[model samples]
Target chain A: MKKIINKPEDYLKEMLEGIYIAHSDQVTCVNNDLQCYVTKTKKEGKVGIATGGGSGHLPLFLGYVGDGMLDGCSVGDVFQSPSADQMLAITKEIDSGAGVLYIYGNYNGDIFNFDMASEMADFEEGIRVETVLGADDVASAGPSEPGEKSTRRGVAGIFFVYKCAGAAADQMLDLDNVKRIAQKAADNVRTMGVALTPCIVPRVGKAGFSIGEDEMEIGMGIHGESGIRRGKIEPADQIVDEMLTQIIEDLPYNKNDEVAVLVNGLGATPLDEQYIVVRRINQKLETAGITAVKYYVGEYATALEMAGFSISLLKLDDELKELIKHPVNTPFFKQ
Target chain B: MKKIINKPEDYLKEMLEGIYIAHSDQVTCVNNDLQCYVTKTKKEGKVGIATGGGSGHLPLFLGYVGDGMLDGCSVGDVFQSPSADQMLAITKEIDSGAGVLYIYGNYNGDIFNFDMASEMADFEEGIRVETVLGADDVASAGPSEPGEKSTRRGVAGIFFVYKCAGAAADQMLDLDNVKRIAQKAADNVRTMGVALTPCIVPRVGKAGFSIGEDEMEIGMGIHGESGIRRGKIEPADQIVDEMLTQIIEDLPYNKNDEVAVLVNGLGATPLDEQYIVVRRINQKLETAGITAVKYYVGEYATALEMAGFSISLLKLDDELKELIKHPVNTPFFKQ
Candidate 1:
């Protein structure tokens, strides 16, 4: 694994400095550390939006922070959640008079740490905090059956939640409203991903998992969690159908129900393959009598260079539609 | 080499259908073929913006088209430029009474085909066409010497040109002014890239190039062009030094000059490594006494899972700064 770095230890610091230099106008590093980039403008009445997660997913946490998206982002080490202290500091820094909203993915460490930070903000800092955890990946646990609690895992679909929440904030919605809208978006969303290969974490120095050249793991987690099933690499149409079937069945979207569809390539899948998946997914949606109101087919969220994709569907209504359509200005997503 | 596709040939069409469904409110596929997604409400007086390149590089061309960025994008095969006829159809369909501006990366096929389409548009449809070729990869081509032509290649730095040009178009600038702003943005930019590993095109189903696990290629092209030199993967600081030294010397930006910087991950490099690269790049910029006015670090333009990264600099002026800062609403870039 040849890489460009002074020492593996210095990787995080160097990267933060570069991000700050690039987005200096819209953001600045807090405490001169690359852990957080807070927006420059502090609107008195706007709810401060803060997002955080692992490092590899760019334009998700950092790039999405700007005028119309996240107010700040707490970046952790690769695939690790930021410390509660770090999230606390960022929350304080970006907090306006109104309140602060925490939008993050539903990972174990993230949930635990962010919850602690939220409590600290309320009791110690006198700041109100609201959170909306994005748990769109359907393969995280399983269906919510009698014994299955459906352990929620956050994946690329968090980007959509950020967009919607940011739009709500941009519209001067309060923290409660923002959290509600974000949660609504999250609840209506379900995603399932497949992986052809595993990614090598810089620290790990080897692939997180192993997949044979002829096989793929379906419902793989971004952090390389064991997926629901493994099978031979099949045609794109079959692969997409399997992924979308799980998502559609889980969400139980019905005829005339509008939805936003996202077919995301997990880093390594060529756009050509992703597009092919999207085409098949579209045909499936039409056949199922579902109306895809909005569709995004690209690498919105990725798992390093894992050569596969995921399908995300966000069931939409009038309000969700308006929120999804709301204007946003961020480095990664704009609409 | 596992992949998900029933037929490689139908990849583009399927992906375009999915994209159109997701963004139907803001974009739609022209001719029902999903080759081009034109804006739904292009103002009649504004210069129509059209961008297209290969498929894998997401948000680069497709995600950038919306309310304020591009009018439409004609997606080609992965890493391959769209055909001349496709370009011509996109130009013709997206024309909003005003002239159309074709903005794209400076690849050989893209240049030739887009040029042909522009000529056809002018001669056949009288839809006065102009073009701005993004040539920001400083390592690929040097500045033109006295009477000598530059072979500059466009890479991730094209995003800056897109923002600036899109802003100009949003302001309803005429075709000439739009072209001038775009060219100015392009002229002020420079980039250099290094690859840790080569990418594999889906159609080809092989690595674009071969590199040892312990080696890296410096000054590599987006499409795997031979780099200036290859060497063992060095430390992040040293790599940044090498990349920035050449770029700074080539552009010779003054101490007082302000610029926008982009530390772009070429597909496979994780965010951890990207941030490490960004850190060293910023430190070097500060050491050189250059003021980085703005910075973006992420996978803006990519080469399908190529394990590499690039650095881009756009020396900023008041006009360029304003344009860069202008509000942009697209699926990929919002600010």
Candidate 2:
């Protein structure tokens, strides 16, 4: 694959520099390495918000770091989690005097690294560090399987936790309260994605997976993991219904429960199709008697040009609703 | 190609319904048949902001209509312009006592229909209507052929105008002032795009154009128009330089000129690649003695699943800088 870069290894560093330059007023380089871009605001008594995971997903980890959102975000190589040291550095920089809260997706590498970093911060720096892992992809593991919780991966639904955690932090909520809000958002949320085509990793110069022109993989992970099922490409409305039904069944949300629906285009799905899917999904929600208090349709969390989308539903209450509705100024998602 | 719609004709209408549901508190459906979505806020005595175009590009027209941006947006069939009647109705609904300002990208169909609607609004309703067409794609047409100015096609650079115009309107600038600012933004702007692969229009169910794996088309329009040059897919850095050279030369921004750079992903380019391109572009600007006051990198305006990107630069002065820095609360762009 032809890519524009001085060296493949230096790609991430150069990209981070560009992000900091564009958002200089709002963001700054955390360390000399330039992997982490952090917000300039510092609150002595507020909980510090830290989120990080992979590089290709922009406006997610990087674009989300600003006022009313993340305090710091550490970016790794494409689709790869940052090392424990990198996470530790970012946590240390943003700790302020108050406790630091690590809100990240529930991917294995990220979980392990963040956990290690939190422990390191607690022991070495005497900073209180708490974490909330987002595991909202219902398709990653089935209910029938035991000891499969570890296998359940985090996808785009992680944004729900970010919003909740960010709002809590902005309001100067304690670490425990922030953790609770983040966990509540994560637990109430469920997502399932389908991939019409595979994404090519620039370094690899090949597709992460293979799919025929007429087929699609349902419940595919953002990083191109094998999906739960594969079949011929079906109508968009049917595909949306199937994805929504799986999520609804997994969560089994009550009829009166209010929810925030996020119909996210993975990367390559056109806004045309995303809106079409959202229409059917809204119909499904109405039929089930669920009140969609808040709905977001866009490429909130995306795979690199993976022609597909995911439906993430976060069952909302007074607190979650307020948090999600809180005004955020990010490069990608702004309210 | 499989899609998620029940009926092809109902796609746009259903999609508009979904958008309203997502942002119900902020936007409402003006006309179900026309797929017209209008913002709830009606600023009295302010130049009513309005924009509309095709449907596949999200956040462009629909996501952009909100508190500080557009008052209404008329979504067309995928990659097509709205009818004159649709534009007229939206213009009528959003028109406050002051007047309605039509801010649109320059496309043959859109310009013609919007012109017709403006005439009707003037003759029928006596509502003063002024238009500022976004003609930022410098690569669309070469130096003026005898008796003709360059036919600059509108691409992603339209977002810059939206920001400036919205800010002007939000500040209650008169229609003439708003039009002047928007036009200045449009005139100062220049963009160049290249497509690695053609997009697949949902309505058409086929690729918009053909390209081999190692091929690319430079100066391609948003809707898969034939480019000025077709060549082998070059490195990302080279592609960025090529695009930047054309924009820089066409606009001829000087050393003392402050500018806002928008390195927009045309849907399918990964964030990593976008950052890589931005890094190089920033260096080029610095080397040219140009000061980049603001920069944006994301899928702001897109050609559905077209694996490409465009660079937009607007020479900024005091007024332009203030407008660019103004806070906007649109669903897609928040500052």
Candidate 3:
């Protein structure tokens, strides 16, 4: 309720307008609609990668649209999915001679909308569009059933996917290679989160959920997707251990396996605390003989003003490593 | 109060450990103290730019240490000044024949500690460390006298000073020019914030202050410093108009003045809301015929999880413009 927003209904529209103004040099509003903001960094004969999702998660979908990153982003209302029309418009806007790739979090709404966009782009406009779904949230679905992997929601690990895919695209890779790299990035990533408090949806003027003072929801998805376990909040070490254990084991990262670690905040958590969690994660990785080659810590993806954090591990190979290391100059995911 | 910290007492120590671990490639802890993280990006005979302050402000003190940016930074406990020892050690470590420049926000603790470090660095290490105190927070103090400008507290606008000063330092400007540019940046900048909710200090486990559900404090400082006025929380446009009016007029910014605007989140406010604030800010400037040459939004400086934002305008010149657009890469800040 204590938000600096205008009309709740205009939240998405106004937010994108602001972003376009702030980053006008790097991006432009596509189709005169605020939902789709395409980057001015797009190059001819390069694969155009796009990602979009609900609003409120700053730097999530829109933050990656820039140099060495996504080409366009279709935004939705806070925690809601963008319309297929918006996505299709962005696909057309970003598509060069090369094809377009849709990379996004694994959510029902996003899947439906992006799928529709893909079909419409291909059938209606004869544009080639491929999809790479991200379902890295380990707690949303278990690894015990491989078939259910797609049921998992995406979290902070999507950033890893975006980086690799974006970098690959930036390297002027072919469309097939870009999709392959994106899928590999998606498959190699895993994430788990803890929510200290629920975020209030601006329109709702109330939190999506409530918790006791000392309680936290472990493995909560970005949009308050039901977490697996809720219990009394523990210390930083305990929380990091519990969350990272699942993420590492779920990915089955083993000895001598190199990876990138991202300790991301879920809105209100301070970067200092995220770094604390990353410190523990690095120690844990060292003890396990799993080398964490690169580390990113901060609010990469958020759930409104929720006070929690997520640990994402991307099992890395030389290709993924090189791709991630490629300089990215986006407003959010800068290298 | 909810937070993702292990122990309030260990917050600073743990946070620094995390930072060292996260950015080990680009930075290193100086003198075995986690508080003083110096960048590996320092070049021989280049004026070192060092800034530091309380721990809670993300990317304020520590985040700017990287290539083409700050050469060193010393961090303090949450909302507390770092010890003079930490500052002195960094001054020594980053000094590469060229003198060092100390650019930091104007807080009492920071001023006292940094001044001590400056004196010690001069006496013990024979290093030249000129100071440019950032007192751009327009609301913290009034212009009581001609020389009372130093009485104002620095807020998010300090980032502009850092970017410009760091860029100048990276250009290998001599100590005097670097200091002059830093002072120019400080003098040209002004910031005013509105606070919706106060943040809780970890040790205290309580908010610094409280506000009614429907109330907001305009001109509030990042650390809950008393603002100019309190009133019912208004619409986004209303708040932006009120805050921007004071900031623009205080600077007495003219119709033809070209400026850079930063609509920064205090901590917990969503990016969408910050954008909304920025949109209004940009519009207001345009309406006044003042050109906002550039815009920077997001949480440049935060007060823990305080739900508010500040608007900062830096009267820009050709020198400042070129310096700001200079390429710099750091973990938290990049352009």
Candidate 4:
């Protein structure tokens, strides 16, 4: 594997050490534990927003912890879930009278660990915690029926959930209110992706899967989860049209509805290619009478050095519109 | 070729179209031409900062055009310089009576065109214009002796020049003062890079250079330029040590000197790998007693999808420290 890394075992640890050294003024680890990180911008009586998932996806779980965003995050290995103790430590550290809200992707291992951490925090520390799973990948599951939580896998659209929920928490919203907002964002956002190449897990030292280079896997998850279809690669506009069609139809975003577009690069895709996809999306959305009110085209989420791209659309109301525009400061993200 | 693009000839046009659609609120083209883009956040009396180069590197030439940064930019095809006329158009559009300052990479084609633009702007439009070429790549040439400017190709270190010069302009410094700060940034910063893979230009439709599966080219230029050495890829820390050694010796940064670090990814390099490099740089600088005052890591400049990374250090004084910390807003960069 042609990767810029040391021993596979030290990958996550060294990455965290580098991050801590670089951004000590804004972020700090919990009790010197590299697995648990919390923002230094904590405010008393403000609801804490915490997120966690596997490593490799920088700016996703840990990068969100900062001013006007997540308060804490527990980190995992390459694609493995963090321990419950790590999550509990973060929860306890971030909670200050106002309860904590857990915002993470809808993955089985992550859910189990976060749920266990939630229970331990309540039973052992008397700290209240709420949960909101980001399930916005339209390919993994169909759109939720009315009054039903989605069963989809979360991908890049989780950024919108962290953004809106974090803004709500920063506004001093109560735990229930913040959870409600997080859930609303989760419900509104939809994502679809196409992978041109598979990424290698450091420990594995080889790509989990492979395509014929000139081929692509449509709807692949960040962790190399099985996608819906694999076929020869197509042009940028055609690929974007396919992804956008799924995203719009999944939410059934109606005429005159507005959205925040995130054309995220999955690791190795160039930013220029992402903007090319955005060009097609703008044309398609304009034709559909859906106005994309804001555009965020870059790598917000990724899968190691996988060569691919994902398009996420967050349908917006006045509340979400304002929340997404709220100021935020983080190591990876700034607005 | 595995790329998300339409016809090869249309690549630049479509990319510009997408950028205009996404960032219309912050940027606009002069005379409705995609070749000349200017920031919308223009002020009447503030000195204008203009930069230009090829189109492949996002956030390098064009992405810096926004509030508190570049006032305008001229864009060319991939890895090619924009024409003199396009540069002149950008100069005319952004010059708000104070003056326009040109800050771009040090390259033969770019220098020729920008100098022509400078002459045209002065003789035809009576607009005062000054130029500062970024010659910060320590790998390209040896360090400059006292009273001499180094002859080196510019790489990602241009970002530091933009950050300092743009802030100086935003503070309402006149043309000469802004040019001085730009030149100082160019003089103080040094960069070195290593590439594991070569990128395929869309028009070329193939890699410009190739290496063995387990090898890397040290000190390669962004556009497949020959490097000082090629060998089996080493561990991340070892590679970083070699790079940092050259950068330290070039600047000869002394004990207790402060610097701003930029561990930039060249397109296909993962962010995680960049941080791993940063980890080593942090350790080395600590040992040397140099304080890395700030860190800006990610893809600030890139070579299409070349898998590599560059380290840029801007030796900082109190003035540069304050200027680097100055708040700015752009599509790709923010502080």
Candidate lDDT (C-alpha), each: 0.80, 0.82, 0.87, 0.91
Clashes of each: 25, 7, 0, 0
Model 3, range B155-255, lDDT digits (tens) per residue?
A: 89888888898888888889999999999999899999999989888898899988999999998888898999999989999999998988888876677
Candidate 3 residues A1-335, lDDT tens each? Answer: 77888888888778888888888887888868878888887589999998999888988888988899899999888888999999999999999979899999888898999999999999999899999998898897754555544678888898999999999988899999999999999999998999998988888888888889989999888888889999998889989999888877786656899999888878878777788887788888899999988888777888888889998889999999899899887766678
Residue runs of model 4 more than 4 Å from their true location after superposition:
A142-150, B142-150
Q: Model 2 chain B: which ten-residue window has the lowest total lDDT?
A: B1-10
Superposition error at A92 for model 3 (Å): 2.0
- Going through the candidates in order, their DockQ values are 0.52, 0.61, 0.78, 0.81
Q: What is the overall TM-score of model 3 with all chains considered together? A: 0.97
lDDT of model 4 at residue A118? 97
- Lowest-sum lDDT 10-residue window in model 3 chain A: A141-150
Descending-TM-score candidate ranking = 4, 3, 2, 1
Give lDDT tens digits, candidate 1, residues A116-198: 99999999999999988888888875557774534789888887788788888988999889999998988888889988888
All candidates in order of DockQ, best leading: 4, 3, 2, 1
Across A1-335, the per-residue lDDT of candidate 4 in tens digits comes to: 99899999999999899888889999999978998999988699999888999999876779888999999999999889999999999999999999999999988899999999999999999999999999989889955588775678989999999999999988999999999999999989999999999889999999898789689989999998878889898999988888888888887767999999999999888888888888999999999999999999898999989999999999999999999999999998998
Better of 2 and 3 by TM-score: 3
Candidate maximizing TM-score: 4
Displacement of residue A64 (Cα, Å) in model 2 is 2.8
The model with the greatest lDDT is 4
Candidate order (lDDT): 4, 3, 2, 1
Model 3 stretches astray by more than 4 angstroms: A142-149
